[model samples]
Target: MNPLLTASGLHVTFPGRRGGPSARAVDGVHLDIGAGEIVALVGESGCGKTTLARALLGLVRPTSGSVGFAGAPLSYASRDLKTYRRRVQLVLQDPSGSLNPRHTVYDAVAEGLRIHRYAGDERAAVAAALSRAGLRPPERFFLRYPHELSGGQRQRVVIAGALVLEPELLVADEPVASLDASVRGEILALLLRLRDELGLAALIVTHDLGLAWNIADRVAVMYLGRIVETGTVEEVLSAPRHPYTRALLSVLPESGAEPVVLAGEPPDPSRIPAGCRFHARCQVLASGEADRAGVSSACRTRDLPLLDGHGRAAACHVHGTP
Candidate 1:
């Protein structure tokens, strides 16, 4: 399938203060989001997941590498990139924090439409956008303020704002992380419904594997700024190959498995280990010898390349079959 957006060798680094070297946030990450597909990017906090999302949207200037939208290198100055922004919108996680306290809900959702100079009637566009976002009976929400709406309502307004642009892709950064668990499911369902109704392609950045399991068509597991594993939702959740991926999957509730709580925190980006970044906490490598099937030793001390195995690509040396 032809990709709607393709980013290759993406790298982002923040210069350390006091003349120290820069810290890598996104380290040569590559990703593709095809039309009408939902790809979930999952990882723990501080893993640079947000940075990657920003890079995709061109909000962050990558220290190195390029982003291509619809087969052309994205150029910030070009009308194409502006159009791209309109076509590829972002639905941020915190609606309460994201929305303007003073702006009426109608103004919030219509903001994008106004910015993009959408057709003849602005009010009609605003109403259409709000209706599509499930703020039904649009008039009810038009005069409502952010503080007046429920958490779910605020988020739906945010989604309505993004949808107003009629984007081809949506990058949602932990869209439901702050909501009550009860509302999380509703938000996910809303996104799924939008995808189906609008034929939207979405790249959902989240930490919860369970959420990915429920809504994503495919899952890409990220760790320390690089993607460690990727496959069909079933392949990844059912039998993750990378220790990090497996560990993440294990931690989800009722997975019928004990979470592998690898000891130690993720290494600082500037001080990443000599080999595989996860080696220090890798249980397979802690034994100091290759296990019976030669599966344990290399999860450490090797810069494992993502290779095809178990129907997807994984970066764990122990699990890459070929």
Candidate 2:
């Protein structure tokens, strides 16, 4: 894919607290976000979705592998990194936490411009960004604080902060997770509009499959710091090949399928299991399906090849067979 952002064999490791095993926060991840394309990085907590997004945004250095932007490999040098970050921005999950209560909306949105030493009219840029983010009558919010606006409005302000810089890519971490149900749709629509109008690509980091279904063109299902499935939304969500993906979808209130209540402990980054990394709780293996297919032993003993996170694929021995 001709992508605006790309990660190849990306791995980010953090030493465990108290000298425990190092946590593989992001391990061998590969992803591509094309211009105007919205790719959802879906996974539960500690599955490394956020860490992967941080790596892509150049917030954290990868322990191994590489990140590329606009066909050029990411540079970590001070000046180059600053330039690189200016083209990519992050929208955090909580509007309340991301926004500075001490700063007025104007100051919050203008912070990036000030940091980048923008050369144009700061007031006009802030107004244009706020308007672009759907905060109409931009001056109305110039004096407001985070507590003065609704959750949706606050989120719009946060988005405006990112847009002020005119970034090519937005890595939004659960952009609407903190909003009320009625407000959630608004934020999702805003993201879509930004893409359609400005040709801005986004990697929305969320665990909500339903959200991915509504806003994303593509979905990458991550588990234990590795992508197990990747494809167009219709392909992966409608016909999910990975067992973990299937389980996640089944739990959605609208899926109608019986919920696949996963047994065993949740995935641990500090001590990842061998084999499928998901084999311990796989329904197919527990139901004797993998055994019938003669792959149960492999699922417990063999690790699947690292996924390049491209095309319609699943990295499962029984289902995807990579």
Candidate 3:
């Protein structure tokens, strides 16, 4: 199947203060989202998941590499950029921050239509969008301001605003991270429903592994600006091959196994560790066991590429060599 969105070797860097080295937020990453598919981009904070999403949406220009949509490259030139923005909408992390506090729900949802110059009736479009986002009796909420609604209702308003654009793909950055735990499930279910009902594809950036397990068809584990592992939800989460992935899953409250506590924080992006970026914190490399697999030197001294084999891909020297 042809991907609706594809990004390859994307790198985004920000110049440092006082003439220091640049910070490589996104370092040589690649990803794809097929039509009607839901892919979860999961990682700890500062791992560049959000930066990659912004690049994919054309909100952030990459320092290097290309992003393609529907088999053609994305061009930032005026009209093309506008059209791409219309096709790919972003659902931000914080509903309160994303929505205008003073704007009524109807105005919030209709703003996109006006900005994009929709030829259709704005009221009907807003109504349909609100309804699709699970805001039933949409009329009841139309005149209410952001402050008048509950947290979940506010999030629904944000989703409705995105739906108003009728976008083909949604780049939702931590869509549920700010909501109450009870509200998280509702938002996730809404995303699933959007995919099933509207045939919308989504690239959800989140730190919650459980959220990925709940709604993602595939999971890509990002660490220190790179995708360490990627595979179907069952494959990556059930039997993670990468040591980083295993450590992440091992700490899940329900995993039963003792949590594998990683030592030290992730290295700074400006001064990334040589070779395998995760080597300093990798328990496997610290222990003598990796030597038995004959990949210890490679793990510490060589930059492992994301090797694809079997049904999944991982950037680890000792993967599948037990």
Candidate 4:
């Protein structure tokens, strides 16, 4: 089956001053989210995860490439684009900030219906939205303020707001990052259930690989604004081939290693290095470059491309051969 959403060769950059270098926030990002599938975009902060999402939502226009929703190309002025927004909603990381403090839970959840002009009585729609979000006995939450509810409840209200529109796609950006660990699992489970029950295709942007391991059908590992690895959860997580992917997996706590220490920080978007952006921090265990760390010259000079292997693809010269 064709993907529900497809982003090909997406590139987004902010123009710098006449002489200054422009910032490359997203570079050649290609992704495909199938119907009813949950694809996780995992990366560190400032890695353009949010930028890619905004491009997908048409909130930010891409400098190059295309974003297709369903089967048609997504254009800013296209009628399909407007319908796509309603069919694809975003649940922000911070429910408190996303919802208006002054608006009661009912108003927040029903806002989508109000905007979309969904038929029937507003009150009935409001209560139904609450019920669907698991805020059962919907009456209780309808009258409650955002501050009056718990973190999980506030998030549910946010989800309900998105669901109220009956969207087929949901872009959840760091949905559980701010919540306490105890509640994070519950929220993640709720998101998963929504997909299973409502057939929602979700693009979950998160930094935690654990979250993706728990909920995603596929995982895409991004580094320096590019997708370094992509595959099913088992293929990418169990046997990640990219040096960056390996480094990330090495420090996963459960990777059974004594915390693997990575060298240097991620490259600045404005001054990205030539060739392989990750060369600055890589340590090819068997390549005799383990001691160089950030000081190594080989990493600073070489470029790697996503190579097919073991039922997945990873961009790392070291793992691509032998």
- Overall lDDT per candidate, in order of appearance: 0.84, 0.93, 0.88, 0.83
* Best lDDT among the predictions, by candidate number: 2
TM-scores for every candidate against the unseen true structure: 0.94, 0.98, 0.96, 0.92
Candidate 1 contains a number of clashing pairs equal to 0
Which residue runs of candidate 2 sit more than 4 Å off their true CA positions? none
TM-score: which candidate is best? 2
lDDT of 3: 0.88
Global fold similarity of model 1 (TM-score): 0.94
| CA displacement after TM-score superposition, residue 106 of candidate 2 (Å) | 0.7
Q: Which of candidates 3 and 4 reaches a greater lDDT?
A: 3
Q: For residues 1-322, could you state the per-residue lDDT of candidate 1 as single tens digits?
A: 6688887888899988798877889887878888888999999999999999999998998998888888888888767667889989999988988999999998898888777777768888778888888888998889999999999999999998998888899999999989999998998998899889889999999999999999999898888878888889998999888788878878777698877887989988876676677778776677554466575545545576533212488776666446
Model 3 vs. true fold: TM: 0.96
Give per-residue lDDT, candidate 4, residue 232.
95
Deviation from native of the Cα of residue 161 in model 2, angstroms: 0.5
Better of 1 and 3 by TM-score: 3
Q: After superposition, how far is residue 126 of candidate 2 from its true place, in Å?
A: 0.6
lDDT of 2 by residue, 1-322 (tens): 5788899999999999999999998889888999889999999887889989988878899999999999999998999989987899999999999998999999999999999999999999999999999999999999998899999999999999999999999999999999999999999999999999999999999999999999999999999889999999999999999999999999998899999999976677888988889998999999999999999999999988887767889998888944
The per-candidate count of clashes, in order, stands at 0, 0, 0, 1
lDDT of 3 by residue, 1-322 (tens): 7788998888899998899999999988878889999999988889888889989989899999999999999999988999998899999999999999989999999998998899988889999999999998999988999999999999999999999999999999999989999999999999999999999999999888888999999999999988989889999988888888888888788777678999988888898877788888988888877888787887778887643312378888777432
